[model samples]
Target chain A: MKRIFTPAFLLLTAQSFAQDIKPEMADSFRSSGKIYVVVCVAAIVLTGLLVYLITIDRKVSKLERDLKSLDKTSN
Target chain B: MNIKKNWWKAITCVLLFYTVIEGFLGAVPARDILNETIRNLYFHVPMWFGMMTLLFISVIYGIKHLHNGAMRSDLIAREAAHTGVIMGVLGLITGSLWARYTWGTWWTQDTKLNGAAITMLIYFAYFILRGSVEDEQKRARLSAVYSIFAFVMMIVFVMILPRMEDSLHPGNGGNPAFSKYDLDSKMRLVFYPAVLGWVLLGVWIMSVRIRIASISEALLNHSDTHPTS
Candidate 1:
């Protein structure tokens, strides 16, 4: 299969390079695109925490709804 | 800035923004193995600091629960411990990643690492102990009692035992700590704010959980009084 590299993918690839203050110091990570892997891993960790927080938030919102219904019934 | 409701939260947001931007962009010491990985200090080490602060808050609430027999205190303690455990796990993951990059190993039998694992184990047991009891008051009292004991053990394992050994981590076996080594002024600026940001975030999570728990308990009480409700 001939793979067509879209502009979006190419942009991502370009930005994946190391944000090195010393360009000479980051020979491998910059050239080999390894820094993006670290960025991706960090993003995954943050996403996991965010998902957990969202789940809890939704659960609380649901319970609050249930409580509101119970209040109506009691009234 | 409303100090009671939103000030700290706003500060947390700003600090976190600064941490994410400056943490990556900031200059770090060019050392041998930890050349670039030193930046992990902002993320990994702050997790430990935030976890420690949350756990300390948990123990304080535990003590308060025991003293006043306040169920709210117990709820806060439980939620704080829960959030602290999550933060601690994150710290362990980040530390492991940093270690793998710097030391060529994901895990080591280092005293500090072992202490961290043991401390995590103790807190995990605390949650399990909370789950074992169905009765509310009994659960609260026993959990409070055990939390105090677990915290003391945690202090011994994490603080004392690690110091008694030669650690690859900083500030062990008479080695100078981070401040003495590479915690230069530039790093400190981001590092302190990162710690505060994470700890505030932990507290925010705990507060939200506590609110939900209280509401659920209220609902349960209402149902007990009115069968239809």
Candidate 2:
């Protein structure tokens, strides 16, 4: 009984929390502080992508090594 | 090879150098009402122009795809659309912030704002439409048609609607744009470079994004043939 009530309470808490914030609140926030938010978000997103691009250079070297190993095994 | 390399690098560097100089000079006093937010105009306007330029390129690719039914054209169209969406979003955000500081409100329901929003929403819908469809060919074909329609609508809404109505936004009918208040040789120096810097930056970002998308596509295709356990 306690387990079932606990799960039900958690679900209700999640739904209630979700209902507390209106979509318009986010829109208002965006309108009010768009420049700062955009700059921050763009910097974060671009940094992540740039880092990913950089890692691909490493992956290419690994692939080259693997291919050389494969040729040696075949020989 | 040296010449070609230098040419691309030169074009990029010249633009960057100019933008840095202009951006620096822009910090100096403006003899107009625009104030500090006016500095954003140099960055913001060029982004909007770049967005328009990219959207036009997207339309060209869309038309070519329709004519040839080639996947490569579809890829180009998709890349251009993606880039346009980014620039458009940036333009809207910067414009809105500038408005809040200058007009004392984040939004005014002004004709230009409404038009810009509509234009962004139209392109946004293209992405949603593309996502909803499953067949690659059908998705490409339908999105191309929609993009062309959207491009036409965007021009009408942004360029025409503002002119037809009374707008607080400058550059509307009878409203003086940058030209009306003489660009002054000083501003022009910074203005041109800002345009080039921003446009080159947009292209650089877009190329990186496109390369990432292509790699993801290749990986997906590779996995499809060699099912992983």
Candidate 3:
């Protein structure tokens, strides 16, 4: 919740200094709050996937050790 | 599983990055109710597509298991089915959120939504069925058969039944699908790649899971042979 508001709040506050968007132009709502919603969802999903990849990497390393031990015993 | 890894993962990453930046930042059909919420289609719809594709692949692998009797095939099928469910859950969550804003309800008694829930429930049962059996080979065989049957039922729920009844979803009853919604070429450009990116990412995750399963199976075999000193 904080993450969502912080950026938007900052944008809202910083809107005056940001002269590039145009003085008479874009409406405050059209500045894309809904887009932020999409971004938040995407970020959450990607973070979850990244954590999953870390787990898989650890499992693969453990399996490699197990295989190494088995080969040593055979020798 | 043999062969050097190439650019596919790289492509998946790039495509997804493009989808996110382009999907949200890009312009959309600004109609009443839909407004900017239409952007959810790129993320939410692709999740369903990826889940369906993985489920289809899992069923294929399940059939292959029946024919060849390899534990590897069964493992692949299981991993695919399990990983596919992750995407299905994501789809359901995003869809529900999108629905809440658009339809004034987080859920409805719509036929398409009900069918989707049933599809998810059927896959959850697949995992539970996998867990119940004690014998390895018997579990493999039964899981394979169940997955194949489940896949057919999934088609019924996901594809056929919804079309036959009224649905709050598109492409059902008289509602317009993405095609009929005047999804211009610009949106299609991002939407298509978004689907491909998600499906490829599912493949990547499932492949990693299968690799781990294979390794664990090998370790089990090693212990059985030598009694792990």
TM-score: which candidate is best?
3
Residue A67 deviation, candidate 1, in Å? 4.3
Which residue pairs collide, candidate 2?
none
Question: What is the C-alpha lDDT profile of model 2 across B103-215, one tens digit per residue?
Answer: 88899988999999999999999999999999999999999999999999999988899998778898886677766443566667677777776776666555555655655
lDDT of 3 by residue, A1-75 (tens): 546655664565476556544333223443545546666787678767756665775677677787888779785
- The complex in candidate 3 yields a DockQ of 0.20
lDDT of 1 by residue, B112-219 (tens): 988898899999999999999999899999999999998888788878988998888787876667776454888888888888887887887877778887897787
For all candidates in order, the CA lDDT equals 0.78, 0.71, 0.81
Please tell me which model should have the higher lDDT, number 1 or number 2.
1
Give TM per candidate.
Answer: 0.79, 0.71, 0.82
Question: Chain A TM-score per candidate?
Answer: 0.59, 0.45, 0.55
DockQ, every prediction: 0.16, 0.02, 0.20
- Better structure of 1 and 2 per DockQ: 1
The TM-score that candidate 1 achieves is 0.79
Count the clashes in each prediction: 0, 0, 0
Which lDDT tens digits does candidate 3 get at residues B84-129? 9999999999999999998999999998898889999999999999
Candidate 2's displacement at residue B42, Å, is: 1.5
Better candidate number, 1 or 3, judged by TM-score: 3
